[model samples]
Target: MSGVREPAGAYDPVDALLQRAHRLGADPRNTNYAGGNASAKGTATDPVTGGDVELMWVKGSGGDLGTLTAAGLAVLRLDRLRALAGTYPGVDREDEMVAAFDHCLHGKGWLPGGEGTAPSIDTAMHGLVGAPHVDHLHPDSGIALACAADGEELTRRCFGERVVWVPWRRPGFQLGLDIAAVYEAHPGAIGVVLGGHGITAWGKDSAECERNSLEIIRTAERFLAEQGRPDPFGPLVEGYGPLPAPERRERAAALAPVIRGLASADRPQVGHFTDADAVLDFLAREAHPRLAALGTSCPDHFLRTKVRPLVLDLPPDAPLDEAVARLRELHAAYREDYRAYYERHADAGSPPMRGADPAIVLVPGVGMFSFGKDKQTARVAGEFYVNAVNVMRGAEAVSSYAPIPEAEKFRIEYWELEEAKLRRMPPPKPLATRVALVTGAGSGIGRAIARRLVAEGACVVVADRDADAAEAVAAGLGGPDRALAAVVDVTDEEQIAAAFRAAVRAFGGVDLVVNNAGISVSKPLAETTAADWDTQHAIMARGSFLVSREAARVLAAQGMGGDIVYIASKNGVFAGPNNIAYGAAKADQAHQVRLLAAELGGLGVRVNGVNPDGVVRGSGIFAGGWGAQRAAVYGVPEEKLGEFYAQRTLLKREVLPEHVANAVFALTAGELSHTTGLHIPVDAGVAAAFLR
Candidate 1:
């Protein structure tokens, strides 16, 4: 108590303090109850017998730090400690239990004698120490270090021998005893690591305790700095060198099976890795350390194996057994090391655990591999470890980071507390998790189509001439698996091919392809240039062919029924002026959809097109306000153009992107499963002609 000081600045208001805790990632659900439980303090004799203790602010059993209520925080006792810890006295009451226990304790005169009842699980420890404030946390860094190869040694080096390190134990009462013993031995120890449990700090007041907790974490961070680390992963992909188109596709094909195998459980989704040279070069630079230092990333990921990556240097047609053997050799060593680590430190009487595997595989000239039970989980593993590699490589800048110990990791991995997170709702549907490749995604009808697919629970890969815009849209969607924005001039077959590859690599497989990319002109056919005609065909016609070609390859290979949608406009069906190039291209798309549907029907690939009427307004093909001017030129008032168009439709409403999206969804939903090569009108009833 020599360092004790007066309370500072009136505790900054409890609300302010709680907000700070949340900002620091404190689990609010575990910190506060619905009815406002503030403190945890009581004695052993009547552990639950404390009446003066107010609301029992126990961290809710399994609430996230972001959402918790005061009532959700339990109100329990401190004095009923002995009876609660005892054989439970064979009595479980519903309510007023704390009050009954308090009356008994009050009769014995050991109770604190107050109006309120109930205390927290940690009440005894909080009150016995006479500290005005206490805090506990399951910090990522601290837990990670606790599960490392040299947890105790690292702790000693980082925090000094004066710090306390308890062995892994079940939480609650057992933890309290372990802590009590440590405190008695090192009375002045300000911080405590409860092994598999968590970390704790106590101070004369709230501010001091908060400062101590943060400082302790800073100390842990310093420990991380002292340890040499590996490199972090670059973005999903890096720079693409000048590789031949065939060679790149071949490389992607080789990786397809392995990727698919990893994602097979969650459906046969595959990750297509590109920019091979960049990923290869990055790995080559770190071959020595990554191989020797094991691997990077967290412990619970051990099922995917430890940090060291599997480096593959086999031939293209190498036998599967041979490849698996090579993987086995790498994993055997990793598993052995993990076992030895546990053997050296684990108690003689702990339960056995399942062995871990190698989650990361680095193909010499290929990309990285992250294997998991599902595509989503596997990709997360792959990306996170890659990021760790970067962080480890930059350890010189941020300093080396150490992992927590294996035994501690095992305890938490199997901990009941952590297992409770599994009770939440599961993810969305797979087809609902559609993967759509949209051409000309940067602007116009293409962008609208992409947005529509995204709104329908599909992950869209937006390809456009403008790389920045594609990337912007991708970023806006959030997360790699949800959206991929790539720059590509649909006119170039190589970029088009690569764009499809990028989409597959990120989301597993492609479900829908919207050939919505096309260019338009206002010039009369007599004034059109050959170059303009060719460019239009390249994007609107040839571009559509290239994307569909790839989509067919993947869908056929997948054996799962899929859909191909082309965004053809009313120009394909009805005559329109100065639209020779666009009309011709759209007509080509329609013809191809019907022909391809015939050819690919046996393969379960349905091809269709949506012919929209007035979707041209914001399509960039028309100059600013050209739609209005066109209305006037066509002898219809500007305000009546929408009505003029809608009147022709059965729905009597202007066709929006939403209408187009709904049509696309219906086509792909297997509703039109038996229907293919059909042109669905998305322009309300525009095609229902009445010669007025």
Candidate 2:
């Protein structure tokens, strides 16, 4: 609560505040990502006044503390911020205070030019605290004690008056004023436990502020650890035990697509599945139904997980098909209830109901399935729920877990400030929520296609027979949220099925599939071997069919329209010499596209093909000696084969791997939605391969 004097030439307060934030945020026990704010007051030469002025730099809205940067700080003039209190509006009109923050912004070099990062709702809590440094965090341990029914009494016992208790109030200008009043009244108080929220602490210096924050978190953590009851969630209900690891994963994979379909009614959604110990323990317990319906207490927590998750009526070990059938009914009921909840509390000012679908779904024995417009959001939602579970357990250990009332939840959920934040977000890309699975994506055309899909905002499954190559492509595409590598031999049905399952688990389900795996063997009839003919057919024709079959099954399960494109070759149509086995395999692939297109039309699955000429540059097949064999037959040097092929084409252009990739993207990226069973040639106007 006390601090040392500011030394001469001390480090910038802004830099020191960021270091403090990072130190506190490094531990999950201190705060969740982007859930808290830290601030420091320092003197800066004002650009307008040309004199020293006190400026407060606080973590701006919507930034994680651990990764907080200077740009994320909202620099504000303290004198102006304090002046707003004289013109303060009542609680009902407090939302207007956010707009007023603009007048107090210290910009024109202090922050990014023009308008800077918008201030968070809790900005007043930091500015009005009358301390040189302040922190507000939502650690699970603190939230547990805050949500307890006897939180006021517990706070008194935990801190012995060093930390006071403030009653439940939704975060806003008025709540900030309330905390400032508490800080002024209790000169001995270093922090206060916010009822149904988190904790806040302040100090005379940055170091003291960080120490106070951690002490509060650690003390409450120890209080709960020692006094908390064993099995705080109560004993597991009979017949609701967790399934084996293999079975849990299998069930989650089987149901992820179905849940994704229900959740994506408004827009496409990516999913994340978790069967961690906390989730399983909570799901199997008797208290979950009561606590889950009560929902999370913290504002940041519910903003992600929603007020309540949709819990399954059937147990996890129930008959698989029956459970799935019942799940559809459960989801429908959940939507109806959510719509009613919005109607009950919404007035004219509430943001239009953002989607009635549940964000989190609990399957008793399997695990939890969370969905969002992108993979990162889904993963974060799941993580927040796990935190909620921990809070419930701890609260029940000491006292009953009581979250903020439903009306308050609705108010916060649709607050105009929150709605404004949503509106400020940029529009999604063309293929924003679409997920694509590209076979042979380890190198060549497949790699190009994978990278292209991800660039357009699609989550990609980089599938290939080469493990290292597949991993490299996936890594280049992005982090796990964007692309995941699947080592698969498409000719093997089990591995193909597993790859599709991996796609479903990683990003909900596949919406676009590229069957680009292939092999080539050019030889005259006299020299062609039976083994060569069978191998080509197995890798190209059979592999394409297997991957397509699995893709179709998932698409049907999801009831979402999807695309499958086969990367055939120009030789499929052209009667080129010494290209028997390779040409026959490509021809088989070309016909299969038509057959599947006809069959899958009713299911909203489009089937298409791309026939490309000899792609010599960066071609895995060409680099594997096919180029030398073709060059020998054409009586041209191996290095000059590309030029020779280009001269023979009407356009006289050498086809590269990217050209094949472009053709593949064209067939599936919605521009050709109405076109199917079609083969667009990537070859440079090869007259012999033109389709009638």
Candidate 3:
């Protein structure tokens, strides 16, 4: 006990840190997504030396605190890490400090895999702190005071001497040293406000540390509220006011793909759209342009949102064509400025520019659009930008909004430590940034196709008439960020339109669409009623046409080639007896695929078909009595229908939902990049259904 001090007896620093992280991350007011880090100092018995050891556990790189686990904590020997300060080469070569972190890692045998976790660039901030518990957070309220012109005076008024003020320093080893020095000098101080950054708080215990962090955040919030400045963002701009909800959504759907194309010009990217009140209010303000041009005050915000946002120059509800043209013009200017920014600050040692495209885009009346390598990243990026909006609000309310200089942002953005972090990431999947919409996805073949697409790294929109089934499928896929559900009756034009809009709202736009919604009517030629034919044709034939038409509109707007796959039936080619209505409807769908492929190929929208022979095992149509009807016609029991269909094929293998799904994925997964207007028979060698 005398040799090394622990935060508490029988304490698991890793577990306590994770618990505190979750508690803080559970609320948006505490920290932005993946922003902030928590650490705890504790004692561990060294398995090899059989001696007492002091260690620190902090959140590792690229992990969300809300979802953090013991595995996400980087474990380090406190003595070895503290020794890093002694050999530190000073500010000019501060990045070398990060590479040295690996040597300080502990947990070889005492803990499970903690040594494998990669510490982030903020590692020094936690290890160098004098307190047993430390929390570095990006709360909006704290950031507001941090960036105000009178920030030091504001801090003094808010926390008195309980919290101190640290000068502006790019986050690195030097910054950590500055904070540690302040903590040691002001022994009574509980936290420090980092100028042009966020806040950091420490305490003798976890509970006190969390409470102190909250105190700083909430106190700042209360102060801002008491300021009672009504026109902080200034009076509303005339043309920038938010549109009604329905009109706003329509406008966003129209613009999402175009915005996504602009953002993905450097590389493929996924997108997220939000009309949240925070984004709407900020965009409608008269001061929006002046402040947005100033960029973000926090490193966490600018890192994800880029140097600044691209704000639309046109009116919120401008004509579609005019809006598109203006966006292209504005985006071009934004890109030029960003390129100049990179050239101005980049050095021989600097890493190549990551991209010139904007991660955050502000639309006057509609909403905000954010892009990233994936859905969750894009969503979180949007959330961080909203946090920036809050910071701007509070700062303007108190005094003025002041951000870190552009040169400083470049240092943080292009730091060697950041480049190494990027290099550590694994390569993306085959369909990394592709978004897919699978119709009839509530069950059967559509469900399987949705699963396959997500497995290949594509975000999915699960569309079905059954609301409950759609929600269940979406939940099973991951969460809303990965797979979203839409209530869609494909036969209805409005519902089909709504489904695609949901796709755009949820994931920017669609790159792949499966027209799988179908209804079957198995009846003899003598008993084939007019209503039966109408119903089948309406769902299978007309529904595909409508869906394809909408897809072509969106894909052309994006100018990005995409795929439309029709899930036809083998019966369409085989002419199975007593299946006139179903076969006719499917035949209509199959030919439509060929026709649309020829029509849409110029837009690079590939159209294909997958014809499956009697997918009875998991077919929604089969569950609706089509299986029993087909069994009666074939003189087989209902349960033996699969065997009967399998025996009919040359391969004598029963077709399945998975088989149909595999065919869909194969056609659209880019392997057959140029092969379109073709039909792939997924009936286990159904020669009758084979394409000529």
Candidate 4:
């Protein structure tokens, strides 16, 4: 609370600078103390080894400004500096800490008594200023202001005409030159703050450097006062308890991109921290002002925090569907506001750069979330925003505050590239985009789904109880180029396990599964023996479950949800004539689909069922016996079986295996990403079972 400063009575300039750095919001925890070296006079470290003569200063590795020391700030030879700069442009480009050291020590221009050690990163600029004393520190207020929108305005207001403003650029000889140019242009200027980066100050005397630094602080304080805004955070309450590991992982992942984007878009020079809760809180509370400010440290980070953060109270593990819906609604409203703002302030030929939507979502328990192009930045932004929010909330105990307009937030949220990444990644080929494993695929419905998936750009694996049939279909479908075949008895667990393993090995992973391997019996419930019931259940109920369970394992590991489409029958959903055991097994399979959907949703896999009315395609038991009986009852000839079934439907259309295949395609294609656990009737509306 006392704030960082020199000891109560000490006149140590370094300590004083550190104190201000703390007040300005730099995290002392991340600083590097005694990490630099300096010299009063010029001399080479290896006296007899070098050829040139000049004075130099350099920073040691692993030390940042917060923890750097005067002793750690190295002073070496200028001749060496120039030699290294010429030989290794990259070294000249590195911050003075690393780049200057390599140049000053290893080159031919070593000066007499000039070598001290590695100097601070600002050493190059020190020579540019030709100053005996120089100060370089990452100030939080400066960073906070620099990372804000239109931060240039704040800089102008704070430094007035006496200071120079350099746009955000990476640190190196180039940055040093830019600072030198500005200093030379404004002869009387004593300080410069890199736009979206940090601040730099130099003076003939240490006191002068200190004076200029304090001037920056005072300028910012005055500017903030003139803005007349209260703290963005409201009354303080206990922070929500930490999120569980799974939920935390989920939230961090979801929020990382947004936070990273905000940082990149607004403040490029600033780095991100790993702490999630702290960042979340900061964004939730204080990010609006920065977003509303003119410039950020970088540009892309806007994608993470958006233009600002969204404050809301959401339960952990809240359904993703509901969460996305809420975000979409908020985004829409934000966009409307942005449109109005842009229209009101339009300048001919120059359109606004971003759209509406807060990049970061501030959930009460979760803190701030920053989004970025990469995960690291996004995670950092998220943590940064959360911490800032906490700071604002703490200040709130002393005053009231308001956030920036919602519309401004949206303009950046819908920024094009940010939105583009979210679009689903297109599959490899239009026809072989997804991978499907069709059990009983050698013929009939299984083959139909496999063929359809293949036609739609998905690779198909024709798995059947008959190896020969499987091999034939596999060959017909371009022979391992488009399809694979596996001999598998659905009722046998060992066979099912082996088939899936082979499928995964053959293909990178599975995208869709068609559990169509089933057996049927026409006996009444009363006459059906336990053995008969077991036979049907083994394939229809138990087999389907076994296959689905395995599929779930694969999907969970891939971290992308997949689809499981079961080829159920109308008998599963409704009471049909004289198929007791078959109907019961089918019913059980349908219910299992629902349960699987519920259980696997978090894992990213969706499960659903497709019920075909009647097909006369395969040579299996149902194909010959059930197909003949249905054909006879419908008064259709055997040769016209397919047509007869189609004509009898309410839609007066035949149910082709292809039609069933189409239904399977839709369910797995992500066209119906929100759908799962329900049966899709390919009977052209014959089942008429109005599901609730």
Candidate 3: pairs in clash: none
lDDT of 4 by residue, 1-692 (tens): 11112345645433443344333234422211221122122322344553434444434333444444443435455655544445445533353344345545533322333343444344556555555445554444544455455566656766677767777665456666677678778878877766544466666545566567667655655555566355444223344444665566555445432332232333221112233544444433434334333212322233334444554444545665565556556556655754675665444533344545444545544444444332333444554454334323322322322232334333334433234434534534443335578998988777777777877766678999888989988888776646789888887787876776665444435667889887677765677799988998998899999999877766654444578988888777767666789889988988998999899888777889988777665536456476665556556777688777667678877677788888888887767888888788888767454344
| Residue-level lDDT tens digits of model 3 in 76-152 | 88899999999999999998888898889885423443344788888899999989999999999999999998889
Query: What's the count of clashing pairs in each model shown?
Result: 54, 0, 0, 117
What lDDT tens digits, residue by residue, belong to model 1 across residues 1-692?
11112245433223333443454444321221121112333222324543233222333333433343333333343444434444332222212222333432233222134333233334434433334455665454455445444556656766775457776554444455556667667767776765433466765545666676676666775656566353332222222223345654556554553444333433434343433443454554534344325444333333233435555545324555575556556556656765675565545444443334445656544466665434455565565454444334433323334444445455544433333334433664434545788877777677776776666567788888788878887777664756788777777778877776666666656778888776665456888799878877888889888888888877765555578989887767767777678778888888999899999889778899888877644555543465654576467876677667777677778876657767777787656678899888777665432112
lDDT of 4: 0.57
How far residue 291's Cα lies from its native spot in candidate 3, in Å, is: 0.5
After TM-score superposition, what is the CA distance of residue 215 in candidate 3 from its true location, in Å? 1.8
TM-score of 4: 0.39
Residue 228's lDDT within candidate 4 is 34
TM-score of each: 0.65, 0.97, 0.96, 0.39
Off by over 4 Å in 2: 1-7, 108-116
Better of 1 and 2 by lDDT: 2
lDDT of each: 0.56, 0.89, 0.89, 0.57
In model 3, state the lDDT of residue 308: 96
TM-score: model 3 vs. ground truth: 0.96
Backbone clash total for model 2 is: 0
